[model samples]
Target chain A: MTRVRVDLNISLDGFATTADQTPDNPFGQDWGRLTTAYVGTRTFRERVLHDTSGAGTTGVDDEYAQRYFEAVGAEIMGAGMFGLHEHGDDPEWKGWWEDEPPFRVPVFILTHTPRPSIEMKGGTVFHFVEASPEEALARAVAVADGGDVRIGGGPSTVREFLRAGLVDDLHVAITPILLGQGIRLWDDLRGLEAGYDVTTEAAPSGITHITFRRESRG
Target chain B: MTRVRVDLNISLDGFATTADQTPDNPFGQDWGRLTTAYVGTRTFRERVLHDTSGAGTTGVDDEYAQRYFEAVGAEIMGAGMFGLHEHGDDPEWKGWWEDEPPFRVPVFILTHTPRPSIEMKGGTVFHFVEASPEEALARAVAVADGGDVRIGGGPSTVREFLRAGLVDDLHVAITPILLGQGIRLWDDLRGLEAGYDVTTEAAPSGITHITFRRESRG
Candidate 1:
């Protein structure tokens, strides 16, 4: 039974993304501020950035950061996260990530422009498809191969899966900052704590980690 | 010198109020769930509700609840929170509170229709005025007399004070619930965490209390 999980770093105002995006700095200034705790984690420094200097935070943030990469057979993300819109529909765009991407599993990209599966170094394989949230999850779960199917986000993509009741565990790191604008993560998720056992833990670095796990996980 | 402070209970999605308001139950259904950790505090039970049973929580929620009433020489609230919209200007509505209101301070109500001061049984005094956030804060600070002037809110009023840079301390209890709709407290207040030293503490009851105190106090 592969559980569907989500992890996002949002502002106190519930904004998952910042409004200060420019061509020079695509992720925006506040994006760095919003993810200060996560990026400072040893796991993030080693895994995502491929910087194995062993120089990063190793507390609560790193604990969740470790859980982020642990036991996720497959991943799903939006076109924006995959930078398909930024790079255009060119076949040469292998994604914003490095040659050896982070997720070493079947990574499903939700997009309108269908593309051939791009197999990168390591285990990450990007599969582009135009499908509904259910269809996307089915493909991801099928390829998950018994590990948890993680819902990698750009906010809206994660919202779609959450609204469809496909998420088993939702862990949101609420960083103590106000982005005031941009995409909000909790816009349409009213009464989302209905069936999930919600728990929260505040890290010393001023980020609160709130987890909502399904009471009856299959 | 009187410092301007604010205390609010908001959902994880940043909604300060819910949309389930009806004639019978004015506060809406999710309001209770949103403020469960708050109203369950010992200080809230005693100070707000006047429940002398001494039967309430005495944890992190209670600690903050106690701080909510400490040294509050005066308060400024919106007409909505004052129930002016619900109850017409018959001059008979003594603010929907009991004869002895919880706020034993000069309560400034921002309204279009000004009314003479109404002195309640306790030290609570309702003074209706048609002034901007600055003007209202000025009046409240004038009466504060060395104690802190609290910006009591219905979301918008607090945002006004926050935007005007009149707040010295802002403590928001982010309850782990999503209303999905209603008044957002963090709108238009971009980069609100700028100069303030932000901190967070997650309670066992699943409420994360985030505080932002101004680094430089006048």
Candidate 2:
């Protein structure tokens, strides 16, 4: 079965990113710190940063980070995550990721104003579409070709998919920092645990990795 | 060097207790499930329930629950915790605890309508007082006799102390269940980790124990 998964790095207070995000400051001041655990992982350095220096922490955090890219295919992301609001009608904004984006699959960007698909150097293909979470997921799933569909988020997007009951597995790495104000991942996500079996593992890097896997509906 | 500490069992969404809290449903529908991790501990059975059966889990959860009563002399709680709203105008009404309450120290209840102190069985004494978090901490510290002063909460009370930057150490046990809606412990207390050295430990019972030890001000 193709699983729908989401992997996000959040603060201890449940904030995934700060509020004052802009084109230049995509994640605000706390972004680096919030994702310090993942960014310092060997998997992140190799897969995301394309760095094979063999640097970065290798343990519980790395294990979890490595799992982030283990399975299947397509990704569904929010407009804010695509850096659209910042470059506003630039007609040239590819994305925050470098020419060779990390995601080596068909990426669906959910936005109000759809744009032409942008295929980067790598296997990543950004296909902008204005559709509901279910529709987007369906499209992503078809593109995934039986592989898992990843719900990439900036908080609001993830919350929508979760509320729609489309997410199958969710992994949240809670860093020890506290971002006073930002987009909260848990807002409107009441009784979220009722549908999933939740488990937590505390890593040596002071990050608590929480995974929620969907139980059988029956 | 007396420390001010807080120990609370919160849901995955940060709710310490549910919203529809009543005298009959003191902790709301999910109370039992949320606190099962703590209540099932041998320390809770012995100390709170006064059970000497010695029949309870004795692992990480038990170890942390056992520390709930260590090195704390006085306790400060809210009126809701004292059950004043339930049995209003009934002077005979004491707390919901048994004739012998679990707290074996001077217990201060912060309420707008202060009443005469009530001495319960065992070493627990309920003293009603109307004061700010700092003032209440001062009174509790005085009675603590150089011991630690514990901030016993129903969420709002703990938020106040945390906002005042008076807590020396805070321990929050994140239960697997989600209350959906209730009194949130992290509301308005943003940037809370700035003052504390935070750490986390995931227990076998699926509870994540998060601790914040205040960093030296100087």
Candidate 3:
């Protein structure tokens, strides 16, 4: 079964992105503070940063971090998340992730200006497409080959997928901080827990991870 | 030392109160759902509901629920919380808590129309005063007599106290539910975590308890 999944780091006040971003510092200080728990995870170090050394936390947070990467055959993200809005018309710019991007699958970037697919190292291919969430999901699912489709986000993109009820599994790592400014994740998602079996676990690093898995509709 | 404390049940989307309130059902159904974890606790069962059967959850939720009713000499709350606005000038309305009120201390009601103090059976005296958050805190602190003053909330009252930097301890039980409508708890309190030492714990009942204690400014 190909499940649609989402994982994000949000503040206790429900902000997923930081407002303290600048031209120089694209992801502000609050972003670091919010994602501290995820970044400190062993799986995050190994997967995202490609840190080969067996360092970093291998606790509950790492367990969730490990789960985030597993079973995700394809990813869909917004143009802003791909830094296309920032690096406009720069054909050489291939996103913040260097040669070895973490996602080792076909990543569909939702944008009007669909660029040629750039195949990075480690089996990661960046495919730009001008498609709605449903269309993107279909593309992702077609290529997923029975693996799960992950709605890899920068908040807004994830929210659209959530609003459409396309998500089957959702996880949010809530850092114990309040960034009063940023893109909020739960703006119009009232009564979102009706169809999902929700669960919460606190990490020692002060991150409360809440998971919502959609039960089979009987 | 007389510390200023606050405890509230908020949704993951930051709503402290529910929107599904009618004249007949003042609290509404969402209120019951939001407080299910708290009301199911042993301490809440004994203290608030006065259940002597010793039947309820005695887990992390109970521990916090037990602490909520402790070390409080006085409570400061809003007029709405006291149901003053709902039952205007009706002498019989002693509050939602029928006869045996929860707080066994002087409860200061922040209102424009100061009425005669109502003394309930269980040492719970309701004093109405038209004062600001600081002024109410001063009155509460004076009567507290070396005991901590708890800002018993309706959300707005607690936010006022928090904005004034008068709160020493703030604990919020983030119920894993998205309430699309109602009063938001976190607003304009940007960089609110600067002085507080934050911690989080997840309860078995799917509640994420986040505690923020004011660290020494020095």
Candidate 4:
């Protein structure tokens, strides 16, 4: 069975995005610290951003990031992350990653409406699915063959999977940023049962990398 | 006038609580880091939990946490933070704060139905209000006098404030834990206009502390 993983950054006060998420500020104050910590090092940045020259080095955070990427064979994302085109009336919107995206595998996007598949350079293929998380995961698993499926999130899609109990191993890069009010990953769940054990932890470049494996409950 | 500040911690992948929230694992893997970094420090534990000290003096995270508490005169939270309890035939629920919550100020809970105020020792009063976020803030500000009003969250309340654009400063301590499935701080606002500037960045105890100040579009 393919292990499902959903990952993202969170603040101490508990907010994912800042109040107003305009393009000028992608991640408010947290992105820089998170990026530097996760991608700042020579080797890590070069690897993820697809650069020839590696600038970052071997640290705990870098190691965790590397582990996360290495474990991912396929990815599932919410439309919120695919692009900000959801807000505008135009249908010509693509994503923030002009032409080529970061993921180098088959990526499935969860949306209410369906669209044709978008093929980017590299092996990145964007497929829009209007089905629920489980349905998408099922299709993704078929496409994944014998690899782990990573959930690229905008929060809601991840929550759907979590609510449905579909994720396996998870890693979250904790970035120090507070949005005072944009979209928060934790909203209406006060009475739910969830448990996890820390599999790994690292602190580097002012970012903390922690991994958790969901505990199966009878 | 005391400005209102929202403070929190988040994962890089963006989850506030685990997919299923329970007391045993109130916040999934993030809670452990928070306990050790925010509440487990010798100085902080003695002060916030045992009342044997004032506050932690050193470390970036300690300093940031101290500053956040100092800035708040009162806290306004949501029902999600209160956890589950059987109130009436409708499953009446109270908060999970137990007898004496760490907060030593007036705490207002935003809810649709009003309840009698429950006063705790050390000045923490749980007042259930059926007012809007603006109304709750008004009461909080008045109670705070000249102290900053802190919008303690569950997500809905935070979104209320964020949508209103009433928050001034945000202090976030990002934790390195991923629930993979849980409530997120930012699930809505698919097409909202928001912006901010990171004024401070620091890493201590493996957690990053980042501050974002709301910016105007003009």
True contacts kept of each: 0.99, 0.69, 0.91, 0.01
lDDT (10s digit) by residue, model 1, range A39-70: 99999999999998899999999999999999
The model with the greatest lDDT is 3
A72 in model 2: Cα distance from truth in Å?
2.6
Q: Which is the better candidate, 1 or 4, if ranked by TM-score?
A: 1
Q: Per-residue lDDT tens digits of candidate 3, residues B90-207?
A: 9878988999899989999998988899999889999999998989989998999888899998899899989999999999998988999999999878778888988888888899
Model 4 lDDT per residue over B90-160, tens place: 43344555577777788898766667788887778888887888888889988886788888776566767
Model 3 chain A TM-score equals 0.96
Which runs in model 1 stand beyond 4 Å of their true positions?
A: B215-217
Compare candidates 2 and 4 on DockQ and give the better one.
2
Stretch of 10 with least lDDT, candidate 2 chain B: B20-29
Q: What does the lDDT read for residue B187 in candidate 1?
A: 92
Over A14-45, each residue of candidate 2 has an lDDT whose tens digit, in order, gives 88877665779856667888888899999999
What is the two-chain DockQ of model 3? 0.87
Restricting to chain A, the TM-score for each candidate equals 0.97, 0.94, 0.96, 0.83
What's the TM for model 4? Answer: 0.53
| Sliding window of 10 residues with minimal summed lDDT for model 3 chain A | A209-218
lDDT values for all models: 0.90, 0.87, 0.91, 0.64
RMSD of each: 1.3, 2.0, 1.8, 9.4
**lDDT of candidate 4 over A112-166, digit per residue (tens):** 7767787888777888788888788888888886788998887777767776778
Itemize residue pairs with steric clashes in candidate 3. Answer: none
Judged by DockQ cut-offs, the docking class of candidate 3 is high
Question: What lDDT would candidate 3 get against the real structure?
Answer: 0.91
Candidate 2 lDDT tens digits, B96-188: 897999998999999998889989898889999999998998899889987888999978999998888898899999986656688888877
Number of the top DockQ candidate: 1
